[model samples]
Target: MWTASAVLPGAGPADWRELRRDGEAAEFHAATEMLELHGAETEAYLHGLTAEIPSLYVIMRETAGECPLEIVQITASPYEAQDYTDSGEEIVEKVPMPHGLVAWVRDFVEEFHQDEIFVKRKRDKKRIDIVEDGVGDPRIDKAADIYASPSLKRRRLQ
Candidate 1:
């Protein structure tokens, strides 16, 4: 289990730092990741930040190259994380957000988040009961009774 212990503020250049090693299990820390916020994604970020735990989602992807696993993304938006999880190869983990980062995200959301107004679309009240031309029951020929099937039409003709 790869757990994010902490995010160093303004740390220069991030790389995997080995934390501890057990018999077979080992822990590596990837630091100095910058979480970018978008104006369009503020709604998603707000939804995630308001959660009881207010956690960040870490997305790890399997690489075909020399590195077996790679840190693809770290997102505050659960929606973004969910998108990555749709691909079975990616591993998504929810890590608890730092208090300072939570506050920072709150400020960003407050500044960018705008309430979208809901407008109910008015449906057309036009009568659809009247059958249009060439839209009647196709089983009956135009020369036969509208209610009659092809068999009935043949019998009537006979």
Candidate 2:
């Protein structure tokens, strides 16, 4: 089983302390403690966490109005903090995965991920006669002109 949590920067220590003091505050707040996942559900959630789009925009309702900001996503099973920004900003803070978690992820990837084999398409053998005898060659003159009929006009009028 894996767990996920969303930590917003705007919700500072003071807000967290208040949330701790009043358990009911958690219901109203965007910050969730931990959400458990299982089986294929875990894999699906993990895929979302590992997606290329790192940061997600979330609407925060304040007394004045609603504000939106990009927030980092964190996962527990594989234990990764994906801090991605759309503005091409470099992420300074690093969240290292534990050795056990790394091994587990590796095993999961090995079991599920399969590399697609590249098979080069075989080229059709060139007809030596076609290359040797040009289009207007006398040898191919006996061949029927399929495009000779006016009824077979290729153009279409809109």
Candidate 3:
């Protein structure tokens, strides 16, 4: 079965702990707050945490076959689990995030995360012209010239 856990940083080993699934939601209680997450929202919350916090991570575990358990680290964008998997065997289960953790992640993301805007570069209109003009071979140049000349338009006679 797929299970989710919270890895809290501290001096003690108990800092890393498993979250309990209650009904449709997973819950985690800290000294200050309680986190609960449900359904697909859990995954998004964990992903946000992994992206915003350096020490926080979402782990996908597979408990079968020779490996028994294989752990994969979830990242924000560039290092997604799908990018590393070469075959179906490498696929693992996704776990949900706890409720309190979601709130923490939301706060972290709000404060630290900056969305990157992608700007599409305009294609050069003269690129083909440059390639045709730069060709040194006489045969290729002749063909290009023939293909490009507007006066060579084919006319149909009835």
Candidate 4:
């Protein structure tokens, strides 16, 4: 999987530039691709930003066209990035998050993030431990050893 060396911001449409080629190895620079942030995914964005080394995920897909690879997605949310990794058909790379992009994400998170409150569930007072009503087959009428197998019960009767 190829990693993005850098991100170049642009005001116009997206385009690519050939960097260099060494026979079989070649590099291209893709520009003007925008990374969008959603309010609903603020939690995922927060998890990514708080990591030890915050990063941007680049997902590339292999194509049969003239271009060998195509950029599928560029994501700031690690959770979203993880989804692409599971497919095994796409290439996922971790690129160090740019300072400006990090700040932008932080601003978006600050505006949309909401803390969820935890609620503990209370157990009902039903006394289920006192009885073993369904432990044995209903066909057997014995009360003392309900756990005994049907064969054992038949043997005891004989």
TM-scores of the models, in the order given:
0.73, 0.28, 0.39, 0.71
lDDT of 4 at 71: 82
* lDDT score at residue 44, model 4, on the 0-100 scale: 96
lDDT of 3 by residue, 2-79 (tens): 343444422232322334767876554221222233333434444556654432334344655643344455433223
Which has the higher lDDT value, candidate number 2 or candidate number 4? Answer: 4
lDDT of 1 by residue, 1-158 (tens): 54554555565775676667888887766645668888999999889987998988888876677555687777899999999989888888888888888999999999989999999999899989987664557776674466555554444554
Q: Which of candidates 3 and 4 reaches a greater TM-score? A: 4
Candidate 2 RMSD computed on C-alpha atoms after optimal superposition onto the true structure: 12.0
lDDT of 4 by residue, 7-107 (tens): 65444654456778899776777545679889999999999999998888888887888766788878899999899989898888888888888899999
Top model number, TM-score: 1
| lDDT ranking of the models | 4, 1, 3, 2
Please give the distance, in angstroms, between residue 146's alpha carbon in candidate 2 and its true position after superposition: 27
- Flag clash pairs in model 1: none
Per-prediction backbone clash count: 0, 0, 5, 0
Model 3 regions lying over 4 Å from their true place: 1-67, 72-79, 86-89, 127-158
TM-score order, best first, reads 1, 4, 3, 2
The per-prediction CA RMSD against the true structure, in angstroms, equals 6.6, 12.0, 13.4, 6.5
